[model samples]
Target chain A: MDLFGQYVVNGLMLGTVYALVAVGFTLFFGVLDVIKFSHGDVLMVGAFTGFTAASGAAALGFSHPLAQLAATVVFALAGTAALGAAIARWLILPLKSAPRLNILLATLMLGTALRESVRLFYPDGSNPKAFPALLPTSSWQWGQFTLRADSSILVVTGVLVIVGLHLLINRTRLGLAIRAVAQDEETARTMGINYTLIVLVTFALGSSIAAVAGVMNGLYYNEINFGMGLLLGLIGFSAAIIGGLGNLYGAILGGFLFAALQMIGAVAMPFASAYKDVFAFAVVIALMAWKPTGLIPERASDRV
Target chain B: MDAAIEISGLHAAYDKADVLIDVSLTVAPGTITCLLGSNGAGKTTLIRAILGLTPPRAGSVKVFGAEVTGEATHRVIARGVACIPEGRRMFPKLTVAENLRLGAYQEPSEAEIKRRLAEVYDTFPRLAERRNQLAGTMSGGEQAMVSIGRGLMGKPRLLIVDEPSLGLSPLYVKENFRIIEGIRARGITVFLVEQNVHQTLAIADAGYVLSGGRVVAGGTAAELKSNAEFHAAYFG
Candidate 1:
């Protein structure tokens, strides 16, 4: 691939990961009007859980890489989903009558606790763990263009995950219930929709998607760390806000835009590439000032 | 026949302050029973008590003679009660068809659901024309139509309408009351909770006046209308 193509490919992968995370944020916000701030830490936990499961699979004599990956991904999804549900059930729901800021603070602290637990307790958890190289490392090359098999797989899987989520949100009864709850919980109840169940399901769904992104991030980078979710979470949240907090399409758009901005920043200044986040965030600030609602603007129903 | 709604010695509270204090009323089967009240009159509380949204702290509530106090809201709704809530809460992002479909959420048979949906569309031909449009994007009058049509889609035994005329012009208010009269004419009981005393008493067979968490008055529509003292305070 040409230099531009390489950047595009790299941005696509990064954007997919960010989009997945942002989708979770948007979904959680849509249903409950609260940000699951610990979402990033949940992603980190999911990655670690997958890592542990992969090792367990190895010890159990499952030598096939694909089988190991499957086990890892499943464990990641199941683990994060449980944690997410617990948070929704025990933490979020109980605090429903409390101020909104309390939920934000509680989730933020929870994120910190998760990060510290992983760092302090995971047996050298503070160090960057080596993520398994399960996918084929072969690359297709033509002239100045090249595409790695693992990258392509990651990209395709991410895209498929997004498509699946879209179908689940738009094509099913569960999706309708979620949207209804989002609009008006009391009204939804009058329609025979269980408000608590939808909230739990939404958190589980969002967390599981984060888990997938966690596993993919590990695979793409060949490394994992306890603090990985911290920056990723902030980036994902920013993406969701830029796209419109309660909008799914906005989340996706925000994710890709954030990624694209980072890519451009890197291209503009190769020697100080670490400052890319600063550049991207600065652009975001400008963008927000220009369009306070979001790039797409929240879908407004006629008021009054 | 069992009263569609029966609430007696009802006491409901938000936190510690009672919203409905010793409230007693009955909504007869197949009749429009208006709960006439101003803001903070506990009318919404009474409706919530029936729907199990706010279960009475001390009361007996029977919907078709089945005790439903403190039951889950959905369960209460499943017993054939539909609420057109205050402010016309629409799943604004959802389409007209989707909103109506949710009203029949417990219906097991898709064919039956479609039949009822068709019936709702038949009643509100405007909703049928704009079935695909997002309900929130519509005019307030049209949104009211969607809300009422949604209530009818459930094929409920009793419909609880909470302030259907909220934020609407006089024309829409008259239009809504006419549609509500149409709903009662279909043999479904209506618990019409409203502040618009004149319009409510016009179509109501019976009504109650709630104030400061108590039943201030209860009478047939004709009696309440003819009572000079009652007319001076509320009918104006």
Candidate 2:
């Protein structure tokens, strides 16, 4: 496979991961107006859950690929959703009436606590543990191009998840309530929407989807660790801000654009690879400087 | 058979500052009761208290003979009261039709919803003309019409309108008042809050002048209009 074609493929796979991770960030923020800093930690927890489940099942003599993958993904998603619900109910709810800065700080503390707790509990605090390889570690070459099946699945599933979220936001009654609450909480409550329930549902649903991305990351990379979420969470957040926080499609586009820039930067100039974080942060800062509202900022509704 | 809305000694405050003090009023069924006041005379406060947006510190608010004090705004709405709140709060991102549909969120059947929607369109044909346009993109008067139409789609038994003529051209203001009268003509009781005293009194069955968060003067529209004190206080 040509290097250029490889970069494109790799970029796409990476973009899919970032997009999936960023989806929750945007969804949660748009609905509740607070960035959930612990979202990526929740994703890391999901990856660990999948890692243990798949490995334990394999050790118990279960060899069927489909069953193992399904079980791992479902368990991870359910576990992450439960955790998200608890956070939304207990930690987030009390601070709903508080200032925006307080919520942000609280989530930051929670994320740090979770990351540290995981490191302490795991036997090897700083070492990467082997994640069970659910997919065969083989690649298929198509004349000048190569694709890994797992990478393809990651991209496809991520795309499907985003499309499904779009449909949920635009077509369903729940979507209407969500959009209404995002626009005006007091008015939505006056319109008979249970704003608290909607917030909790959005948090749980977004986090569960993040869990899917988490499991995929573990499976593809074949390694997992406690702090895997911190860097990735920052990148995902940058993508979300670039895309315009409340807009779903914009976030997806931003993710892909981010990945493409990173890949092209790495290949075109070897020096850029070492400073990819610097480049990504620069891009985000540049975007904010140029268009402070975002690439697709929300329009003010007539309702206050 | 009963008063559409009844408030007695409605005392409310914002934080520690008293905004509404011993405010009391009632609107008869199928009639318009106009609350005429200047900007800070507590008209909006009274409306907000009635909708339970700001719970009254002391007193009672009864809508359709049911005490709705301390109820959430939407709950008050579900009990057959709707408010065209200050600023005509229409969902700007939605189409005029979508905004109307959301107004019928609590309606039981699609058919009933459709019927109500059609009635709204008939009443505000301008909204029908711009049904597919984004509500925010419309002119202010057009958006106000959509806002009022959306309120009507809820099939409200009593509608409390806060400053319906606000921010409108004089012609739109006249037309807007006519629309409120039209809603009243359909046998829906209206509790009208307005700064446009003369125009509101022209169509009102009865009127109250609010001062320092109290009903300083109230009577039949003509009686209030003819009274020297009211005329000097409001007009002079």
Candidate 3:
């Protein structure tokens, strides 16, 4: 029972990370009606940014764990958000009038380039780097299960970040503009909302949240790698699609659902725990076949 | 000092075929000038050209005396041009209030945006009651109120209403026309695009008849009512 409890906690914690990444995909899809395939790589870039910041802080002798966390978040958010805006302006918008497939191909290629660049440029980038222990590491014993405070802090941070994002999208002027652009771009333009400006801001906002997710991921795992974003990006994209690409709640659901599936795969078959990803993916494929539009489909419009 | 919207020798096309050919008209400031046309009469095409959605293949469009031909749609809109498009394109997922607030999107001041929203709600009291309701689920007449209220929120100098009467019941259509007449009464120029000649001409000061992608006739509403060509086209 203790072992079971530990697994549940681990699954929920991982779910938060996936949900964060998935929300970015949903936001990008919502505003522009295009899947930004480079979103995952953007997250990877954010993680690297955080890793670098945390390392610099350690070198500078800022030994406070909370301060280190803050440095990582602020830098990661700034770096990834700028990158996201640049990607939207230069890559996505330029190919917007091109065929839809062009966006997919362009973003996909951009992701590969980002991955390779990190591998080629960053100091010893091909190998994993140890992430700083920037949160309290105290643990509570529950017979066979051990619950760490760091994991709890990570989970709490993820929840707060999501809440902050929710308020930004729902309560703020920028959020209103984002929703208007997503719902009807042409009609939105009629309201004198600058389409390009909103698109840029949306990309930046989504990427910054992804930066938080990347930081959380590195902190949780205590490791970072240049290619870490690839699988995470695939999972995030899948989660977004499963939840309904443009739907916020749907992406969150897909994230948790994906994480749950992985946990279930691992727990259900102890002999082949390493192949749990295969199991989760198989189930995802089946789920797609069953509900192609997603578990919670986008709100339909039948305007005449 | 200048007309609200002036188009001279404007031509627009889709690929090889022309949609609006050599169209020209003037909307004097603070008056209701309507363009009446049937489904394929290029009325919407002219609206698109004026808004720069589909820029004219040839000729110039001046909004309040500024040349806006082929300019970006948002830039044109920012210059105080608001269009109530056909089909009542409400952001389906947003609430009535949210939809209305978007009308004042260009207004930077939160206080001003709130003021405009309150005024719009004043104009459409029913919208005020249903402020929390998603616009997509509202009744057709209610949706029309949202759309018009949205346009008015911008407090535009020139309001281009395209096919406001489309898909509305006679009672609703009459109500919409009444509201439009009220809009012009507020000293704002109105370019009403429509097919309901009788109702439109009732409120219009002057009008033009579009047919087969060209302006077949133009005159005072009374003149258009008595004109032989318009008579055969509509009265018949």
Candidate 4:
């Protein structure tokens, strides 16, 4: 019973991060009508930025860890958002009317460039560096289970981010514009909405959200690496697709489900530990084949 | 009063195929101007050109005397030109309220937007009843109503409607034309494109008969209705 509870808690913690990442993927896909393949690497870059900023700031005699972490997240989000806008403006904009395949390849190349550049530039080529932990390492007893403060922080912060994002999308004028553009770009334009500005803002929103997930992952795992984003991004994207792309609630639901599956797979058959990636992929494929539109498919009329 | 819309020597093409060739027309304010033609007769292309969705290769399009030959779609729209585009391009996934709000995207104030929304719902009581309903799930006639209502929310000086009666039942067709007539009654100028010649001619203050990208005949609705050329082109 204790083991089961712990697994559930673990799954929930992992799910929240996945939700953040998946939301970014779903958001970009919703507005642009193109899968931004480089989204994951951008996340990895965000994590590195946070990690470097925090570590550098700490070395510069900033004793307060929480403040450093907060500053790191803010700077990382701003930096990654700029990078996202650049990607949209420079690489994706020219190929807007081109074939989907070309854009996919271009994004893929950009992801590769981002990942390889990080690895080459970092002191350790392939090895992971120790990511600084900001939250208290203390644990609390809940019935028969031991819950770490760090995991609790992760879960709370994740929920806040998701809720905040939900409000941003549903309530704000900018969100309405994004929804409008998503529905019909031409109609949106005819309504006096600027296409270029909307696209830039959308990219920035997605990238910054992805940065939040990246920072959380760095804090939770206490390690950072260039290749980290690719795995996390794939899983997050899978969750988004499974939940239904463009549906924000669906992404979060898909994230939790995905995390639960991973924990269950790891526990049910210890041998499955090595094949976790295989299991996740199989689940995504099966879900797609069974319900091609996704678990909570977005209505067709919302199409741009 | 300024001309609602004036296009001088307008030339436009769609992907290497010339759709509008040196077409020129001026819509008088506070009247309905109908562009009557059969399918593929460049009616939609003309609307698209005027809206700046497709740039004219030659000539000028002026909305209320403001020359907007190569302006962007948004700029054209900002100049008080609203289009109920062909096929009633309503955002399907959005609720009626959501769709209505989008219509007033350019409006500066929330209070003003809310007032306009109330005005829209008041005009289209059916839409008001289904404010929270998804737009795609609505009937074709209802969707058409929402589309027109959305355009009205923009408070455009010139309302361009393309094929509002397309794919609608006869009863709905009458209702749609009545709505346009109501807009005209309210002193909003209309540039209407339609294949339903008899009814469109009946409501129009003046009519332009377009065939093969040229205005073959132009006169008061009564005059066009009596023309042998109009009858030969459409009725024959």
Q: What does candidate 2's lDDT look like per residue over A53-140, in tens digits?
A: 7877777888887667877888898889988988999998889889999999999999999899889986675678888777765789
DockQ of each model vs. true complex: 0.55, 0.33, 0.53, 0.58
lDDT of each: 0.90, 0.82, 0.89, 0.86
Docking quality of model 2: it rates as acceptable
Instruction: Kindly list the interface RMSD, in angstroms, of each predicted candidate in the order they appear.
Output: 3.3, 3.7, 3.7, 2.2
Clashing pairs in 2: none
lDDT of 3 by residue, A1-304 (tens): 8889888889989899999999999998888888888888899999999989988888899888778888898899999999999999999998888988889989999999999999999999999999988888899997888899988888888888888888888889888989888888889888888889999999998999888888989988999898888899999999988887888888989999999999999988765788879988998899999999888888753110
Tens digits of per-residue lDDT for model 4 on A130-161? 88888899999878888889888888988998
Chain B TM-score for each model? 0.96, 0.95, 0.97, 0.97
List TM-score per model, in order: 0.93, 0.90, 0.94, 0.93
The runs of at least 3 residues in candidate 1 whose Cα sits more than 4 Å from the true structure, single-residue gaps closed, are A301-304, B15-17, B167-175, B226-236
Which has the greatest lDDT? 1
lDDT of 2 by residue, B170-220 (tens): 999999889899999988999999999889999999978887787888888
The better-scoring model by TM-score among 2 and 4 is: 4
lDDT string for model 3 (B1-236, tens) is 99999999999899998888889999999999999988888998899899878888999999999999988888898888888999889998899988988888878888988888888878888999999999999999999999999999888999999999899999999999999999888999999999998899999999999887888889999999989998766555
Ranking of candidates on TM-score, top first: 3, 4, 1, 2
- What CAPRI-style quality would you assign to candidate 1? medium
Which one wins on DockQ?
4
